[model samples]
Target: MPLNKKLAEKLNKRFAPDSRLDDTYQGLDLTYITNELGEPITLFIGKRRPDGAITGERYVRTIKRVPNSDQIASSHWDLKGKVSRS
Candidate 1:
């Protein structure tokens, strides 16, 4: 399923305060945060880990960010996706 507009908007507001995503764009498997001039800032990718005690698994990722732009780029391994700002 695609991400709801309201939820996406909220995330965009939280992550990319200076810019807004297009309404037509659906759920994002990956998201990148770029500077106003379109420079890469950070990279985040998702991962899944097995939990022996739990019925299901947990998802997480290691994020890398650049101090200069304070932006972020994220990818989802489970979803097999990647997003880059520049």
Candidate 2:
């Protein structure tokens, strides 16, 4: 399922300073989904077409909350080995 309104907005603001979303991915067409445990995961990242459809690279990163804070942060989120579309 897609992220909820509040959560989506929070994530967008948190990831706003991410340069990789532009320099590396070439665009900010990212989608965030949470797992059963409510942990945010970045499932897709790519470019958004004129029609507002996102199409591109897929990722699998389990985001975690920062120690002593409510803020979530990713560590070594860079794409690594084969990431199957599944």
Candidate 3:
């Protein structure tokens, strides 16, 4: 996937190598899919195990752009599949 340059710049501060936007955690890795306009639309969240295996969770994270601005007013994360405890 191509990098979202505009969003990345806003997500990190000068001199900061890390992204302010949430991506990964102790055992989970996240990948994103963007639209033609370079906006993130889909997310693939994977959970890593000690046995070198991974489990995945698909989600939709929609960004609401602020009217007449380059800023995102808000965003929402919604799980894609049926909800259940494993």
Candidate 4:
């Protein structure tokens, strides 16, 4: 199944990115993570097409976290040919 609106909203709030759709995978397929409990987790934003289409299948390549990592006030995203960290 494809990512849904509720899950997308949750990821959006967590990242609260200036733009929600900014990558290239979601359009082609679904990407995601499942927690230890086996629940799906979204670690990145969706992709936005030039035509203004918002898709929930996109994702980040290396979603990692370190304790006390350089205090990022907000989540981030970057796309340079491929989606990556900001």
Candidate 5:
């Protein structure tokens, strides 16, 4: 499901400085680490294959937060290529 605006806001506030989200799959997992604004953050975790190879490991993309309705509307448009798509 799509994340709600209120929930997004809450997450933003909760993870503002030193909090994050974690997800797991089998023996693999991902952690969204915190970082300074405009700086790149790293994601760590994933499973190794039978041959000791790893897959599905990746970094979480940094997204600049929009703190106002106008920015949020613009972001929505950018994401969907139009405001009415959602």
Candidate 6:
């Protein structure tokens, strides 16, 4: 065995978006929007929970400019981050 994953290596799958937006836990909302200068910025809008096992919810979005239309797309639970449950 080569002890390596060729598919992962080929695609450079080093990181993936978060997937923890289930209904079991109440979570904060996320917004990816263009700033005043037309630059994209990611924002997490909410207070962190103080509980040990409390998890937060969020979404990721990007502003794409189509030929004749500007589309704002989003994917829920796409924020990759770690929370210390301690």
Please, what is the TM-score per model? 0.22, 0.35, 0.47, 0.24, 0.30, 0.25
As a whole number from 0 to 100, the lDDT of residue 52 in candidate 6 is 23
> What tens-digit string does per-residue lDDT give for candidate 1 at 1-86?
33344633433333443342222123323333444544322223222123212112122323345666555564221222433332
Give candidate 1 misplaced runs (Cα > 4 Å).
1-54, 74-86
Q: Candidate 5: deviation at residue 27, Å? A: 4.8
Instruction: Indicate which candidate wins on lDDT.
Output: 3
| Stronger candidate by lDDT (2 vs 4) | 2
In TM-score terms, which candidate is top? 3
Instruction: Kindly list the per-residue Cα lDDT of model 4 for residues 1-86, writing each as its tens digit.
Output: 33455544444433322323333333443344444323334344455445555343344422445566732244333332344333
**Candidates, ranked, lDDT:** 3, 2, 4, 5, 1, 6
Model 6 TM-score on a 0 to 1 scale: 0.25
Q: Which window of ten consecutive residues has the lowest lDDT sum in model 2?
A: 17-26
Model 6, range 20-63, lDDT digits (tens) per residue? 22111134432233344333333333444543233332324344
* Each candidate structure's count of clashing pairs: 2, 0, 0, 2, 0, 1
Query: Which runs of model 5 end up more than 4 angstroms from their true locations?
Result: 1-13, 19-23, 36-40, 48-56, 67-86
Give candidate 4 misplaced runs (Cα > 4 Å). 1-27, 43-86
Candidate with the larger TM-score of 4 and 5: 5
* TM-score of model 5 vs. true structure: 0.30
Residues 1-73, candidate 2: write the lDDT tens digits: 3333453444434443322332222235555555544443454555655654446655455456789876666
In model 6, the Cα lDDT at residue 42 comes to: 36
Report lDDT per candidate.
0.33, 0.46, 0.52, 0.40, 0.39, 0.33
Q: lDDT score, residue 55, model 2?
A: 64
